[model samples]
Target: MRREFLFLSILVPGPDHPKISLDVFLQPLIYELQMLWEHGTEAYDVSCQQNFNMRAVLMWTISDFPAYGMLSGWTTHGRLSCPYCQDNTDAFQLRNGRKSCWFDCHRRFLPSDHPYRRSRTLFTKSKKVFDAPPPEIDGYTLLEQLRDFGANRTPDCGGNGHEHVYGAGEVHNRHKKSIFWDLPY
Candidate 1:
């Protein structure tokens, strides 16, 4: 059976509503799903034999990058906006206290395991800035170095315990809120 979650009224204005932002619509939907998952039933087939345990309810949401960032509770802009490599991203602080990353398309040419991948401190602190050697390994050969981290990547480590995937601290009005920084959930 197909199912859908009604997030808001269709009568509401379209994108031009100004007040109707993507996150505004999704936050309630996500909260409802979280509530349902905590107190909901699993799908069962009449013809199939029932087991002792109830089936687990799982939800998967698909959206574009901006929407995904809103749903996942991560920064979408600024130097630290990159959810994957922000921990190791090389950025410099401006007089205004905002960080600006030096984005060079040439860095993509570097190997996945290169010291520069983890942090930019290596290159920035070096004496010779312009002088650099060609990467010995190609991108295709360096895929092994890439490993997925974060709660989204490994949902069930099955060790310590479990936690809520979606949560927040003090919110900024109804439209903006601080997303929990731990995991996507």
Candidate 2:
């Protein structure tokens, strides 16, 4: 609703970021959220002086780009950084910066008859975007994909001297199964 109403649920003491280990911290919160969503809790109304069932739902989360990656279990790096596009991303590495750039990647989302789709000078020079935008993936499909990546199967505690493989060829940007997916909704 408002910035003042937003409360910090968890805070990681920082010298280093939590990275993949963030999922461990989120497990408890996910459990509580599941309970609130399913069974809810009893509450008293002050003015009416009545007892009622209080339920809560998490609509979405707010975070910076890097933190979003951690929370969503998507790696916001490399050529396939956009979670929406996934493997269909049209990003390329910059020649000078040595970083991935998504320049002119959004043309496919425009209408087929849009003038910019046929313009050579507007976006990438001498290129026309006739391909359709990436297909939208659903939650169940995403969970199936994550099952292949072996995410959410075990605790993701760091410093175990074992390397955790991310994306694993099947998915380009997903690093792990997000804790939010555990919710039935």
Candidate 3:
């Protein structure tokens, strides 16, 4: 892990957010990563005293919330802000601010016997939470769901020549199928 942190690649310039166009910048990196996964590079091993094939897999990414949306193709704003919850999100539009807010949405995840679950005044007034947490969707299932969605393909941005479709079917908050889905694994 420490050796992996020796180098960091910052793809974009600062002061402006890339939004959906981030996939364009990530194309080269994704191609290189695909090559590494398929056919590893040769590296000299100092301790082994021989050259060996070196391969790497991208386990995860580190980024702030806004950037997370860009990378994952999920919109962080609006009522469907949460990728995990998907269409089941309890977020509501604020009456005054006219913005989406997720207040008191986590009570469903608390234990049934927990006092917070029954405290009406503590959260939304007189509201009792009996709902269970959203089902956990695995990576393969997600990939299967997005396979035909034309991921990383935006017609305006030199994509795969497919028309960009937003909020298609159950993928409510998604702007585009994420570029990371291009990885075969």
Candidate 4:
């Protein structure tokens, strides 16, 4: 039993350090944004902001981590994706129905699974629904457009921060809209 459980851990990502709760990693990521706002105008802070300390929120995943070590299902970059589809899955899903992988990579990192434990409430309520023919919400597929736009570069290919209004780039990033992206026409 311990062996089996251990094996699974390698395939997922979650907080291993008891004191370092899953949410702890989010601090750097979040504060980085605040710092950017406070000092982004200066050329020095601009480069630091680009690194995005808060990016951990977007890069974390459970499959890539273990309770104390790894088991399997890791990528060359130490990332884990949906075993079935091989697509990167984030630790958190958007409330409206979007995956963290698509969201974070655009932010420029991956979602760590710790948030799911910390924000289990929001995570569960926003659970993604998948159907054979395909549910009205793909939740998982949102990354397709993100990759095309951000080129999967944290904050996505067209990294312009939150200003990336859907269809704002009608002539450029004309990614189709879904329940997740409610933009003004």
Number of the top TM-score candidate: 2
Model 1 root-mean-square deviation? 13.2
Q: What is the lDDT of residue 139 in candidate 4?
A: 36
Q: How many backbone clashes does candidate 3 have?
A: 0
TM-score against truth, every candidate: 0.38, 0.81, 0.81, 0.20
Estimate, for each residue in 56-139, the C-alpha lDDT of model 2 and write its tens digit. Answer: 777888888899988887778888788888888888888898988999998898999999999999889899989999888898
The residue pairs that clash in candidate 2, if any, are none
Residue 177 in model 2: shift from native, Å? Answer: 1.6
The C-alpha stretches of model 3 lying farther than 4 A from their native spots are 1-7, 147-171
Off by over 4 Å in 1: 1-12, 17-23, 49-60, 91-185
Poorly placed runs, candidate 4 (over 4 Å) = 1-20, 37-41, 44-133, 136-185
Local error of candidate 2 at residue 65 (angstroms): 1.9
Predicted candidate 1 versus true structure: per-residue lDDT over 30-84, tens digit per residue: 5555565565555556678563334223345555666555445444556555544
- Candidate with more favorable, higher lDDT: 2 or 4: 2
Kindly list the per-residue Cα lDDT of model 4 for residues 142-177, writing each as its tens digit: 545444454222222222222343432232322222
- The order of the candidates by TM-score, greatest first, is 2, 3, 1, 4
Cα RMSD for candidates in order: 13.2, 3.0, 3.3, 20.1
lDDT of 3 at 81: 83
- lDDT for 71 in candidate 3 is 83
